[model samples]
Target chain A: MNSPLFFLSYFVLSALVLVTAMAAVSFRNLVHCGLSLAFAFLALGAFYILLGAEFLGFVQILVYVGAVAVLIMFVILLAKPGVEERRWGWRDLVGRFAGVGVSLAVFLALLISVFRSPSLAVKAPEAPVFSIAVLGEKLVTEYVLPLQATGLLLTVAVLAAVIFASQEVTKK
Target chain B: MLEDKSIYPDLREGRRVVRPGGKREAKPLNFPARRPWLTLGLAGAAGVFGALVGVAVLLFLMEWLKPGFLGEGCFLYAALADLDRAPAILLNGFLAYIASFVPVPPILLGILSALIVIGVLIGVFLSLFALTSVVERKVLARIQNRYGPNRVGPCGLLQPVADGVKMLVKEDIVPAGADRVVHFFAPVVMLVPALLVLAILPYGPGLVPMELSVGILFFFAMGATTEVAVFMAGWGSTNKYSLLGAMRAIAQMISYELPLIVSAVAVVMLAGSLSPEKIVETQAGYWAGIVPAWFVFTPWGFAGFLLFFIAAQAESNRSPFDLPEGESELVAGHLTEYSGFKYATFFIAEYVGLFAISGLAVTLFLGGWYAPSPLLAFIPGYIWFFVKLYSLVLLAIWIRGTVPRVRIDQLMEFAWKFLIPMSFVVVVAAAVWHYSGGGFLGWVVCTPLLLVPYLLFGSAFAKKFAPSGRVYRYSQG
Candidate 1:
């Protein structure tokens, strides 16, 4: 009785996610495809809540649902209109089937890998006193140097992103 | 306050200031002093009252006939056995509705009605503020030496109201190419999170409805919803700029959030609790006088506070960091395809976000609605909080009208390079400062010591700036 809500929510959320992921590849329209992907992200957030990964759930909602989905939408919107059409064919149908097949295969493999391991990992670790305060202490005391280095790493990445975006296109 | 130039201030004038277009089926956005929709309003009210009476009569009849339909095994059924009894559920519901309207006596009725009135007043305030786009534009206009929306009403006092009606009347167009369901839900998705954040905010002591122990956590939860909603709006629009806007939003939000949290960490450490009330109490007086114990007073706290402010601006997608809605770049970004009420929803969500973030900043750093000092303690908690928030909001608006939006790379660099590193330093400094029993003055003194290294090493960052310029020049199509 206690876990029934979670269980029901999990099944529903997982179905939504699976359908969306499948739709991402199956949809004839590219723009519709992006929307299905956004749906998958949203369902994943729901799944996070069901798993009791509250912080991760919010992070999922924030990063994937909010930022990433919004950005993707912007790119799709700004892209050239009337670029693609919904044309169905044996080739398209075959490719979609193949995509589904490959996805299923990979998913099964991942599931096997997870269960074959010593223990099934929960979504997030239960820190002893894990509020924002505890996270802060570890960030400074335990992981201070790596944390600083992450900043430097981010700086280099941003520099690199600029370089890639700016570099001239050359013939392959 | 600026004297309201609208016809509303002219109650004494008695000049029959009829709002043009007369009454309609729906309520106009304007809070009309004169009953514009008197007939419709009365009819609606009459219908509602009739329904309440009808419901109660039906409920009484049903209970008299069979008894166990609505309230199973309850005293209502037992009491109903005697023919005449106390109020039924329907009667109670009707009473609640009636009591909501009238001035109840000086008892529970009065108290309940007062609460309902206050809640409605707050709701109205929030809704009005949400639609205060005209004021923003006017202020921005004044800054730019132009009068905005003056043609709409008396200096455009009723501009937002007019705009609301326009939005209502406009065609709710759905692009044939777009995902209709996602498009429909997108604005709703965007609006819900912004509204929920308002719930956690301690408007003042004994003011907020839900005074949860983990108010900050609830805030964080709501904040995350904005990202998901933005994504939906972008993706549902089925456009390129929308996609780009979503990406920019994600990158910006995730990157800036690190510093935002880091800065907040210092506050949490100093306050030693997640509760907003506790944070305020801790900062009551700076060791019996001399200094303000607010986070802004500390060395690391200052650095953290600034970082937090910048990150908040980015988090809320405010200007300077508002790359998501770079109007010139993405043609209003994720909202390009949106129009009518849908567009209005997104617009409201953005401003509500601004208020929420500013409110959070005031709570965490500026001491959660507490007055500036003991000298000013006579000032109500909510007043100081609002003053701080409005000033912050003004700062945000000022920057919006003034600064050009940052390029994607520069925005990213600002977060990753400067904010990220600086936030960590602040965290460490706070921990060390705490260990040393560094009084409020220590935090005040150490802030400059923390920044001296930045002043010296800042010349190095100037060299890196040149490389980005060179890259852009080399890569231009």
Candidate 2:
């Protein structure tokens, strides 16, 4: 698992993720940005697969790359026909600096939590042979409440979206 | 002028058409008359002979190689286990033989085997794509009472070849306003996912290309990329029709994908695994040592199969569900701006996508490679797999021929109002069937559970949406 090929692929995938994520944010064309975001999501899924969470990787791709990215593209296409170009003003520069500072702060907080975690202090254990069935069992048995909550939240969101869309249609 | 007119039938009829000179007409320099059947027969015979010879050579090579030299994964030994495993074994044996002498690393050997599997899958499915393209036209032609592409070699069997040649030679046109990179990559993106999905399907007992724990999820994940690719094609083309077509396709796909995945979830629940191989294994054996215990044999399974089939049809953008590429409105949809081999690639991707979906249906409901009866178990599993697959493809073609393209709104309504609810019913029915000990009691309970909703939905939809009567406005009734 820790073979040179593994390291090579990991590095390559990470590079792809970073490149695509950067492109997603920087691209002027909204569609291009959406596509880049999809690629980023896909690369992230690949990272999940690399970490041996095959089910999670697939779900990540299916939900994010497949559904979320597509929804983003749909919204972009439906909203406007032209590229979204914003002038770089003093306010924009200040906002960028503020955004950088916030992101850096968040990153540092995450880094500190990771370094301080008790699990990380211990020697790494043997990689467990994880199966989807076990994960599903845990979801239903131990994490059933969370699962139900998520489902309920999603259902409500869907209903709200339907209502909103239907109202607009009626208005039109 | 009169003498020339007498030599030509049209001229003699006073049409005054110019005729080629007798010297030019008399020149029969080369080529025999088109003997399509004879050519086809010869090709078939040659192919069989070549395959036999190739098998014989492989057998001879296996015989000559030392048995233990290639180690445990050697095909020479595996081939002896079951004759059905012979093809895969022989191929692996050949690879193993190379590895034995070459001192290849284990990872490289694994990669090599994976590559071979990928290659074989691509080759087989691409050929299937070609065959389906011609067969689809022929089936549609039969439905329409028209001869389809009979002028091509051997009753249009070689039409795909001609089409390929034509596509290859044709100009690769790109719209001046199109985004060059995105436009160029769209077909490739479309093709990659179509091919990738094929990897997870269990073609036979030990014949899956890439067996992952989450095979079904992987398949759906790969399939999701098609939407992105379609969007790329539409957006990159900078054509409104293309964009609209892409949007329609994406919407239709997303709507139908819910039912598709949910219906499959029923099977996964019953089978107790996301892996297609596991699902197929759970579906093995006969009910009374006669009927194959395919999922479609059960009531919920049957309903799930239907829902999956319909959703699969919509997913592949086939006729009836093909509102995105509705010819009356959108000129080729997202494909309008594509030309030549790029267009050909898109066409191949569509058929391959169809094959993948059909293949998945076979895996889930029809029993992946299991024979219909124990009596038919003599046939190889992959053969049975392909048989089921091609049958589903034929059914798809039949439906495409019979049904008209559905309206986009109607398509959405069907997916959302009917298919989704029915699929949920199927999942519940599947759970009931499982919990109730899965036999006569299961059937009695599940059938009505599925049927009642279906009937209610059908009636409600029909009452609300079905046109009452067509009144003649300007024409006499």
Recovered share of real interface contacts in candidate 2: 0.82
* Candidate 2 local lDDT, B1-477, one digit each (tens): 000111121122212334475433342211212565677788899999999999788666665775545456656668867777776787777776787678998888888888888888889998998888778776866787765656455666777787788889999999999999999999999999998999889988888778788899999999998999999999999999999999989998999999999999999999999899999999999999987899999999999999999999999988788878877788878998988889888988888999999999999999999999998898899999999999999998899878877777778899989999999999999999999999899988998999999999989877867877888888964
- Give each prediction's DockQ, rounded to 2 decimals: 0.30, 0.85
Whole-model lDDT, model 2:
0.86
CA shift of A40, model 1, Å: 4.8
Tens-digit lDDT string for candidate 2 (A1-172) = 4589988999999999999999999888888999999999999999999887878898999999999999999989778855866778899899999999999999999999998887777743577787777888899999999999999999999999889878977897
lDDT of 1 by residue, B153-242 (tens): 445556778767877788888777787887898889788777777766765665554555556755775676666667767767779897
Model 2 complex DockQ against the native: 0.85
Q: Kindly give the stretch of ten consecutive residues in candidate 1 chain B with the minimal lDDT sum.
A: B1-10
Chain B TM-score in each of the candidates: 0.72, 0.89
RMSD of each: 11.7, 6.3
